[model samples]
Target: MTDETDVLEELASLPTLAHPTASPDGERIALYYDITGRNQLHVLDVESGSLTRWSDGEVPRAVKESPHWSADGERVYFHKDDDGDEQHDLHSITADGETEAVVTLDGQTTLFDVGDDGDTLAIGSTAAGQQNLYVHRRSTGETERITDHERAAHSGVLPPACDRVAYASNERDDSGNQDTYFVGVDGTDQRRLDVGEPGAETVPVDWGPDGRRLLLSDTSTGLNRCGVYDTTHDEVRWLGDGDSQERPVAFTPDGDRVLAVRTRAAADASVVYDLETGERRELGVPEGVSPFVRFGNPVLDDRRVLVLHTTPTRRLELLCYDLETDEYETLIEAEYGDLDPDRFRDAEFFTVESDGVAETPARAIDLSPATELDIECLLYDSGERPSPLIVNPHGGPPVQEKRSFDLYTQFLLTRGYSVLQMNYRGSAGRGRAFREELYGDWGGAEQADVARTAEHVIETRDWIDEDRIGVYGGSYGGYSAYWQLVQYPDLYDAGIAFVGVSDLADMYENTMPHFKTGLMERYLGTPDENPERYDARSPVTHAENLDAPLLIVHGVNDRRVPVSQARIMRDRLTELGYQPGEDGDFEYHELGAEGHGSSDIDQKKRTFRLLGEFLDRRLGRPVAASGRGDKQ
Candidate 1:
């Protein structure tokens, strides 16, 4: 038996919930939980508040996704990938738990929207590395390819009572410009709508119940602005102020109003938008819960919306809202019964002070330069003063570290480490220019912002131990972890790079075919177009400057950031005379059966254990007699 005393083990053992959707009748919910070693379908009885396991017998753990109910309550729909290879197939489980295959394909296939009649599905796939949209007929098993664009198209949706499909696609233009395109069911007469001003790119969200008007989100400005595109007039009517993000949750049954989630800074509120009047009203937040709302979707009962209520101190739970009364009721159906919610504390956000300095020490947070842009930093202070500091940066430079429950933050906090999550220049939610700041300049400005953030805390706060600072991240963050060690090695004692990119040139050439379509071209531009920038930004380029110990982790099947990233870094460090192991300056670990850091309970638990061990051995150890902050 495992040692139950380990907080990380406990955190790992806790089951997580995802892809939740309420049944059409509002009487039940079909969601999947990853408790059976693999994700499986589960149903909840809304009336009796009882939960039932739908996919219990499957062994060897098949990862499932897109759990939703059919037009009628008798069937639940979902898709499963084969052993983390990206090959997906859609499956349906009847109310009696009888399973049937909807569509089985050899490549990446996702079931986006299921029609009210439960006979049609909107699917987007990269079957042969040609990302395109397809409309599927359930009864006849017929598939019609819609957009034959060479580039990638995504977010396909089918509105009710219509023979047309709407999706977002980038034809040839780079810079991540995805225009909303509509095509007929038979794959003809495709036309792009004039969504907004030339700068913003619009993506299809949903259609009004009548399918006459399409709901879209213009994300060209970084923050999303909700809009309604009237098919009759071929015009766009903006809904929310683009400053605060307001995304479509679901349209009311009557279709005259859209239930939208409006978020400004950290706080979020649900609002109802009247299409005809063009007015909006904010919904009340539940008492004792943080204003950070992760609303999933409104149930069949148009009067209520499903909200994911999570805090630093508690595990996530599903909550229902009464739009009329503004009351929130918790559903006890989630599988978080055995998990202790009190182990975590809600994280606090603060603005750090960035003052001037010519220079102090080389390779350290010597300057404390000012943040050219307004950014927010989230701190999970261990509650005790003078604790170890972990500067954990998030991935997807476009993704923001919002106020939500994170097990890793809680685990680190519980183990006497203070974590600082920085929303640097490249992070989203601050608008377009802020997010695109690192566009052409990939590894430069963000590095300075991160350095300043840490230095700012060290200067302003007395509780953070300046000598015991470390950094860790995965994906782009993994790249950052290595980058920080080599660029500013004097400031960090240790670092962990998990499935991160170290070479921009290699990623452009080696990443999966779908990623090469526009994602890479959008940010880094082609290495062919900008070889100097790619060479300059790569962490591997500056590997010889390392001053601190580093831990590198990767998955063998991570096609996104291939294992070669870790291998390259390892080879360079070895060439510099660094050994690998507990005593070496560099340590490496790879999960053989995992792909791109799968959220399998065991894989995550292993990662957390490995991370805790590394940090504890390095950061938890006492300083040397002359202590220069080396991992030894």
Candidate 2:
């Protein structure tokens, strides 16, 4: 039998590699690696296949964003914050391990694009209160504000000429709707593109080789579509058939075709479309693995491109694909230590009837316009008959739960528990109507979908222990755990909410300006405009209904969801006569020196161990031999 230390070490010690970017010459790749517990910069040589750590020493902070290579490939630029506060400051490191702070700004700062000549950097920052675009000159050491918008705006892409930039902003109309705009580096000749409709999302993806044509992705027609906007003609040409969801990823090396990813049933495939002939050809990528095209230019050459591939059981691995040979070479493999890769479990896909379509929708506040709702879910079995189950609802009420790998899910499986993940309404990968169903309904239909799906899986699968079911998640998922336990008190035996939102109105007030305007207003309107809806949807309003054992974990420095969210829930539970201690059912764990999530390996291991201990004590751990299947 494996001890707790061995299980935690094996499950939580897997190293990760992310944000792979090819150098300008396409000879080297820069990526962020967490092999030293926290993320750091690493350079991978394409020809030699040797990886070298560029950042020196171990620091408390890790690289927060993708590293950008200089035009000459001598210096790589990245950003880091103070213990995940998200107030990123730009830094540049040379090949010899010399590092210097390039641009230091207040609030959150993002390095959007670096000029081809290595003279300018287009960035978006919240230093002036709201996110705005700016241009930093390398030679003169000067930074100029390019836009003075009242709302948040992000720099999208800077053309090769380095004279202007394309950005996305919601300053024109509703905060929920975003449109693309072009502005000169000197803050002149600013105009919006007539590419997207009102109340639709449009953003620039990449620039063509000629610098006159800009690639765009929009949701004007209720599904993602790629288009090319010509600055000279002031016209747009759409690509692909208007049936399935597709988004432009990058322009091909020669600019003769557009490389895009098409989504179907929550899985993605890479396809290239000929600009002149309108012909589409799908790349022969491996089946069941999602290819992640890095932002900006990912096309290394005419015959080769770089993509990060992932699956349900494996972590992200960088790959170099050859278009001519239809073969891929793994550049960086995810380190799994001495454990067998086959020990991890794969997901089984299932489609459950939406709770709204059922005879009686449980806890649904109002009926949405969606008539037929088919909720997609992934179930990871622990190989034990009658296993304890964890129902994990993903965050980003708008984000979809793809067949991707998750360390937390794998950790749960290692502890003799099955995992059920649902892509509830408002999840992406589905069409517009499905995502819009949860727009104004927050904890209503989506919560109902989760409950119904969990109930359905419990009823159909004899291997799942209905009495040992738990609901857990982080971010919006954390909110779902709170909402699920309160709304459907009898459904869950235990619950864990990590950095979750308990009060909707409070979250709107305390969150960043971009989150408030871009997400909250778009989802449920403003607190003043719809105060009752905010109160009605919040979990704190119904905290009295919570009867299950609940564990609340949050980071003190979390700016996204805020640690106050957990504090309020703990206070409420206390007011309702519940105590928090080793002898108590309600518990709260606050992590210091961390933000929305932790990057330190020790913290991750501690949290995993705590969760396992909590659940084991609450819902007795399954015996290795007969298992919980014999209970029923």
Candidate 3:
């Protein structure tokens, strides 16, 4: 008999690594480490090898995240939830380990910046159901609202100076598009920085050392690009100055140049741009990995740029880019080397005939070695016939699927299942035309693209069992899974959805107030503008068409998608005669304390175990004993 205790023990033994944050002075680094099942912040002195724990004697309900050092480096500020409600509050810990609450608002508080003098804190709060900027004075305990705009404000630090703040707000035009704005410490002299026009939104990613030059990431009309705006001259210069999408990672400490990550389909490379000469140099790294390699954000010192890079064989390792030599050096390697590049299979990219003009490009990574593929297949039989196949459609139906390293993908591969991840049309990384393919045709084009990708995989790969193929995803991906089971009842044999939206109308109405207005109108047409489109695409309207076995997982406190979505679907499935724990028809599980994403390790382990069991049962694979309690 399989022991449940053994499963729990195995789960407790998994290794976890948190992103490391460097102090302002760059002399100390603070990071959250999961030591034997608990996540805690640990500070290490660069010169002395001294380590200290900053978490004050409490088992936090959520993991400590976004740790930033105060201007003076005397204190460290972090976000955590102690009350189990999942609302994060900002807290500060002194160098000597004395901790105190900086601000405790009703909703989640994101600390944007601390003044250079360490007296004023710039924070973004969602207390009013939309994000608004605020400044909290430590000396007087006075909290003043900075931006009172009708739309949401995302706060960031201005370049060269820590006293001034830069944020993006949709105040000027209520069309619900954001524009970059700069404000002083006293919240006066707020002016719109002309990074882009009214409809073209600008996102401030990093500031130059002198505060006179700013690096901005712009995503207008579905294409991503990066540029540098000179605050003094009010001149904007595009990095790379071409058609490809780009992102600025950080500015050099001298403010003379900016480091950026440039990405295209199937290829990602990093480069540095010089402000004075308008010259760009490539920081050569391996291909096939994301360009956002840095742990916290890319940090610059006099000699080297500290970044985190991960190859197919590597998890995430810290590397140093030396400016003088234009070379790279490995600093820290990820512990999981056993499951490196050679162990897993690689995918191939091809052009698919779509919409009469080859409008979309397609890529497929084979989970196993095979030539002949199965079409309209729930499962395909290689030498390992009957082994389960999990088809994961990525979130952001507008986002393209890529050959990248994902933790969940690795975990499933270890469990002896072939996984197929598809990047359909409307996904980013592709050019503007391909990404906007689903703009007015979200459900129609995106859904058809996914179905086509599945058919292509089954027809080309002999390893996948056409009958045992299961669909799984979260958020938009989850919505796709639900839609697939309902719209094409005979396509997938089983389905798993996490925080999926059953009704587009309910999702738009109940989502966090800030994202509700703009995002809803963009993806799904407004309730009044395109009523037919909304009614036709929404999964809730086609619930009766569901024919496959389904398992729905949701966090009860999920404010983004809300638990009610899963609840409504569960109730409908039950009403349709699909019952839980009865030969895999329908089941729903809600984590009492989780929100949009699962943070607790045990809950994550549970989610994986349940998913594995469901797929195993439906696909006729031998279910391995649960790896829950097998800790060392």
> Across residues 525-607, which tens digit of lDDT does each residue of candidate 3 receive?
57788787777777767787777778899888787788889988888777777778746478778877677766456776777
Q: How do the residues 1-632 of candidate 1 rate in per-residue lDDT, one tens digit apiece?
A: 43434556667767777767787778777776776556667777777878788876441143435565677768877766655655567777886668888877656777777777678788877765666888889889987677788777787788786477898887635465778998887898898887754546688887887788888888765677888888999988888666577777667777878877676665456678877888888766542233322222355476766776655566667777777787877774334445555556677778643332212233422333434665688888876556778999888777777777787787777667788888777787666667667666667667766766888777778978888999989888888898788777778888999998888898888887667766677778888999988887788888887877789999887777788888988898888788889888889998887767766777878888888888878887333212333444
lDDT winner between 2 and 3, please give it. 2
Clashing pairs in 1: 312-345, 312-346, 313-344
lDDT of 2 by residue, 1-632 (tens): 46667868866777887778888888888877878766678888998999888886532343456778888899888887777778888888987888888889888888999888789899988888878999999999888899988777884588989999999997755555779999999999999888888878899988888898999989988899999999899999999888879878888767888878888776777777889899887777676555546563576787788876778877778888887787889888878887777988999998988755323333424445444578999999998666889999999877888777788998888788899998998888886678777777788777878888888988899988888999999999999999888888778889999899999999999988778877898889999999999998889988888878899999888888888899988998899888897568688999887888775677788789778888877767777732433332
Q: Of the candidates shown, which would achieve the greatest TM-score relative to the real structure? A: 2
Candidate 1: what lDDT? Answer: 0.73
Identify the superior model by TM-score, candidate 2 or candidate 3: 2
TM-score of each: 0.91, 0.95, 0.86
Q: Which segments of candidate 2 are over 4 A away from where they belong?
A: 57-63, 355-370, 625-632
Q: Compute the lDDT for candidate 3.
A: 0.66
Ranking by TM-score: 2, 1, 3
Model 1: lDDT of residue 52: 83
